[model samples]
Target chain A: MDAPAIYRIALDVMGGDNAPVALLEGARAALQAHPELFLHLVGDEDRLRPLLAHTGLKGELASRFAIVHAASVVDMDDKATSILKEKKDSSIRVAAQLVREGKADGVVSMGHTGAAMVASKMVLGTLSGVDRPCLAAILPNMQGRPTVLLDVGANIDCRPDQIAQFAIMGSIYAEGVLGIPGPRVGVLSVGEEEGKGSTTTREAAEALKDIDLNFAGNAEGRDIWNGKFDVIACDGFVGNALLKSAEALAEGLVQGMKGVFKENLLTKLAALLTLNGLKRFAARLDYAEYGGAPLLGVKGVSIIGHGRSNAKAVHSAIRAALMASEHRVNDQIQASLGRLMSQAGSQETS
Target chain B: MDAPAIYRIALDVMGGDNAPVALLEGARAALQAHPELFLHLVGDEDRLRPLLAHTGLKGELASRFAIVHAASVVDMDDKATSILKEKKDSSIRVAAQLVREGKADGVVSMGHTGAAMVASKMVLGTLSGVDRPCLAAILPNMQGRPTVLLDVGANIDCRPDQIAQFAIMGSIYAEGVLGIPGPRVGVLSVGEEEGKGSTTTREAAEALKDIDLNFAGNAEGRDIWNGKFDVIACDGFVGNALLKSAEALAEGLVQGMKGVFKENLLTKLAALLTLNGLKRFAARLDYAEYGGAPLLGVKGVSIIGHGRSNAKAVHSAIRAALMASEHRVNDQIQASLGRLMSQAGSQETS
Candidate 1:
């Protein structure tokens, strides 16, 4: 495989639960590992400057990194519309603007997801023919490759048009950024039979079949982790609830396991003996391994992370942003959607 | 706690994957556990008689059991409407008829869910005001008690009216059968806020507020496993997908863990230490532990089990049928819906 191109990423230092410290540590770690990478740390100057100075990252490596300060910030509890209007100079906005201005190739933030998405769309704009951007998360699959679940809380009332668009964009991201040669896209439905889904979903599945890509048929929720398809598209309401439900059940069972292990001395001994292996198994199912989801159909790569992300998770998010930019995933998305338009036009004429 | 009164249940012996063996074994187990329990084994007399005799269930205990023959059967692939039209003498239909004739207090079937539901509705009829009969599953929660999730896979396009009815029925079942005192009911939504859901869900949430039951505010998917609410109601599409997704995730993780533990010598040793504890933990999250989900809103108690159910699961389903009957859950549902109707009428006149 050829070496990846050098990519510049704007990292939001004022976001997430362990904000500046996690952000700075992650940046330092990511930069040290990838000699071809460059970073622009966006946050309050006073706090970030001290953390950077304390890092003592000197010499050639230090020259590859810079900090750009923003005056305000978006709190997790802040309304999306309020953030877009009142906090124009927020860190999220500043980082997104850096990508729009070509100062950075992509933007990564572990902040309020709604605010992050709104800021990115407002500053960088959406790709032509893209009505709404959907966020895609890479979940672990048994086939050794992760599958992409899109529109997971990005848009509540996602119509058939949006679902089709999401399938195209998700497939593009899966192929370009995730390194899949050809991605199979599936529509989320209650059943796999021909007439099993709602009218809206069935229409979306029909629309997908006309596109110039591999369109897998309707998939139930169980298919998400089964590795049967690479990309699954659905309305955000169902997607969000399904994603949260899966996460909660996994976490609940793991927590319950810990409780059971602590019941008696024999179980405590068993816990000690198998603690490492159990942790390794749980880590494979952990959402933090990926840390962030990319907002597709946007003009530039924008990564939105969970607010509770720690240093390692922040590092992963920054790495994902760099990978997306290097692969030109946004360009692939535009190309695919353009081809789909032409195909539909020809079919109508015929 | 007072001992639950004996409730005679008609068990469909020709249903499910294991057929006569699982059905006979489960019936024997259930009867042995409850001294006052009685059962009517409904299937081909030839097949069931041998299985019963082989079990050595002789003397007075044998008197508690009876056999009822049905000429036809409902295959898993049978259409719901087609079954009612063509197979009136099917085992599922025969069992439901026993409930209607007052020969049995309830009915339990591990056959196709659609067939079981149709048979029960056709024979026993729906409660006076109920439009649809929704299935309810008790999901194990972190609160040490399971939460009731309704409309698992009953109606395709569940309207606001149905969601309101499900909440009333689910709450009554929780209170009477599950032994909860005034169970808190929640309307499943994308978010906890009143307006943070799809238009249909928002309307459903609004309808729930006017009901006489203890309507908890809107709940996210996380609220289900967190056990924040005793009963959660939603459209069958979302509810089925969510329940199946959670079940698949748990099963997938357990399967993955088994693969991990078998990797090498060290992991194998670790697996041995943790085997007992892990199995115990997995059992707590297993759906088969509770087994069947009942078709709520119908006049008589009807329990529905999966096609792949084993003897243990079949036993659990029969137990659930008995519990529902003994608790007078159907009466509680009728009373609750009656009160809600009167409240609405009085308020409209005022």
Candidate 2:
């Protein structure tokens, strides 16, 4: 009898700050959770083999995974396209090549974000109707459901049409993987008014209005967390700044709270009592819960985790990649873009 | 005996969410704090006279203040340029006009931000050698001293030279007004690397490097709060979004903490014990404590407060205006710009 098909994911274990140890532990957790998952651990084979043995992947479970040897690792300071030339045997490059050659269904990396994006785009290529692949970060909104903010750090200077494409792809991702029906899409701007934004934002708002989706007009920066949008799209520069600023503020506030609670014996006792509640609150705001941001518009699923991702975060990233692949999000994006182009063609001719 | 020279500040009493009462109360507070301050209360005379009488400003204090009546109020939705044509008698317009006609030393408004900017630019005009006026927001950093972030909502699409001008003006403002000696100026970008930003940011960085100032190269979004930069300059759109996002995140976390504390009796007890410590933490992050942001590069000091400004915030704006006028910040800005222009001319000849 033939064996059942398995979902193969290529994870670059040599990337990120915590590196191979955290990644191997996460892989072990993922393998245990999902029996059909077969991981291609792309890194130094000798280092990974010993670590994998100690990580409790014994007996039958050991047969599910394989070590894909990679000679070098991409540095955080390396250029985005350097992996394709000088570091052709880099872990990220090898992982992307696995996806390109159909050896793996998706690629996951916690290395340099730009290098991962470049490797994904150059090796796996973008979808037929997509101009550039964008990163979609699943941020926890006030509403229980997560909001997908696209072009977080990809395509820093985007054209109007490219932004419009992000809205479409982001909507599909939210609807497909996130299970939101007919998600509300918004273009990030200074104001909610139609005419109140930069030239690119204003033009993108106009383009979004013509597309066949639940376009909710312009969303202010406050609207990002106000539960007004299921998906918010902006140029990578603005999105990156906004994301980083929010992260820094949240971290600063948490540290400030810690200092406040440690003022004296009374406050310390109060902190002890409220420790569980604060832990839950912090969990809600933690980016690790969502694992990693997905590189949308690529032909194959590519998840990019944070450099500081822990075992839980890696497990989450692997889960996200599996769900994205299972839901066929790329196909939905292609179909949506094809419809948009056809509609535009009809409008122009009419 | 002759009275000492008074510093006159035009206060727009009919603007902001808590208008009239808040503004009048603030004026009373400012008058009480500084003996040399004389406020020109710009609003309906009938309303101002009655409120002023009830706000504990009697006899001696009443003599220092004067009521300058205006018939109309600029709505929050009013076009930025509408005050020049239609809303001629608006409170904000009259306040700015008072400064233009040399009736007041500086203008303070809590009305429509765009209108305040437009009125300041059109009536008072930009200073010589400065192409555009920008808003500088004093944000609290990890360090004790606050960081000044410029162009918070002014000049969305800025040229490279205009950004360079912002860096210089920001540096001068930080040093002159904020009392930071030789303030470190940085151009806001996605990454700290020189070539990692958009075309505008790259060109602006290049321009900033040549200028005679303590240019700190590129500052990422995280650097805004990390306290590495004394003053960070960026186009209005990015700055506005970053500022708003940070504000929203902080507010959201505070509310989230409140929810966490209210979960049960134990957490509630914990919250009671830490109330004072939490209040102090909140005070540190509150925008009200900072009062208002100054519209720099204008011929005269124009301080624009938030629409939600309460009595305390209104009082702070008046105090800021008084300080800016007393310190002669505008004159210092003019002199700095002149130096920058001459340096450029000499470089060209060489």
Most accurate candidate by lDDT:
2
Model 1 segments beyond 4 Å from truth? A1-6, A53-57, A260-276, A286-289, A342-350, B1-6, B77-82, B85-88, B263-272, B339-350
Writing each residue's lDDT as its tens digit, candidate 2 over A64-163 gives: 8989999999998788889989999999999999999999999999999889999999999999999889998888876555888888988889998999
Report how far residue A196 has shifted in candidate 1, in Å.
Answer: 0.7
In order, candidate lDDTs are: 0.83, 0.88
Could you give the CAPRI-style class of model 1?
medium
* Model 1, C-alpha of B33: deviation from truth (Å): 3.7
Residue by residue across B3-110, what tens digits does model 1's lDDT show?
756689999989899897888888888888877789999999877777786764556679889999998789877787656778888999999999999999889999
Each candidate structure's TM-score, on Cα atoms with residue i matched to residue i, is 0.92, 0.95
Please tell me what DockQ candidate 2 reaches: 0.71
TM-score of 2: 0.95
